[model samples]
Target: MGLFPRYKRAARVAGAAILAALLAGCSGLGSKAPPPTYELMAVQSFPRGVGPIRGQLIVAEPSALALLDSDRIMVRLANGQTEQLANAQWEDRLPKLLQARIIQSFENGRRLRAVGKPGDRLVADYQLLIDVRAFQISADSNTADIEIAAKIVGDRSGRIRAARVFKVSVQTDSTEGPAAVAALNDAFNRAVVQLVLWTTRVI
Candidate 1:
């Protein structure tokens, strides 16, 4: 009985030591792990159209977000100090996001009979030309802002129906890439809403 008790105590001690080692290993591994992040991308869609139009609208998408070399700023790090990260590449390789926002705006207006890409088969009467001017995060504003120069042109008549530059600044609560994107998205939604209303009145 004495030998058995000693053996059981030794096993219990061994198990406790093993568990402690495992937990210690896990803590060290977990501490060095990075948070979740992703390569920011864009998406496009249309809304509020009843039926197709006589002509199709084409949207030209840009390939890269233009990072502003002169607009870099010191961002607050997790350590509570500050660090400088890249600036002004929000629209880079994100043409889909822009195209989607524009399409939704026009669709909401219900003025354009049809909307499509450049190669689409639908015959279009008016084409929308969009230039993303300043879609980036501003440290000065502590948020991201989106500015797009847009124009509506008659396809058959080759006349400029409407032209305007839309700009909006949005503040983000997070300091991560996703937070920055969310800010841009919010600004984009507002811009699209206003643009749709404007298009409805004019065309």
Candidate 2:
């Protein structure tokens, strides 16, 4: 009877040890660290041009496809498939991010008297509508491509005064997160500059 009790206690101790090890393994598996986050570099300024618009201009949030609307950094594979970078993300949704940057670009140019978004309560003279056609990095060639279509509508007339599509492709040395994002930023800046200049000229 003494031996039996001793054996029972030993078996219980072994079972507890096994349970602890299993719990530790499960914890380790669950504790996987997330990937790092990245943000699009904002445009500092565009070249100043003659002040073309003297009234408030409202910038709308650009529209994009479901895949392009997310914070994921997109990549186009050689096989023509689209995928996002592993463990990397954008600071904001693509449309919102671009809208803020476009407003900043106009501000930097100093060509407009005022610029704002939809809810700013600004009595706008014109509205800038944008559609994001392509904003992604090409994994096969290691390049960044940005395409945006812009339209300026007269607030009073409610008619589109001008429309244009701006496209830019910049070669990157690597498809890695940092390099690719840098390239995308450069391309975006170029596109924003063009859009700002064109909008000012037409509106």
RMSD from true fold, candidate 2:
4.2
**lDDT, candidate 1, 1-203, per-residue tens:** 67999999999999999999999999998884433332332223435555443345655553333442222322444444444444433332356656655675565455566776677776776777777666565655577666777787888798999898888878888545567657766777777776665655555
How would you encode candidate 2's per-residue C-alpha lDDT over 1-203 as one tens digit per residue?
67999999999999999999999999999997867888776568766566444667999999999999988889999999999987788888989998887888788778878999999988899999999999999988889999988889987789998889999999999887788888999999888878877777776
Top candidate (lDDT) = 2
Q: Over 4 Å off in model 2, which ranges? A: 1-28, 51-53
The top-ranked prediction according to TM-score is 2
Clashes of each: 12, 0
For model 1, the stretches where C-alpha displacement exceeds 4 angstroms are 1-56, 62-92, 108-111
TM-score of each: 0.58, 0.84
Per-residue lDDT value at 190 in model 2: 83
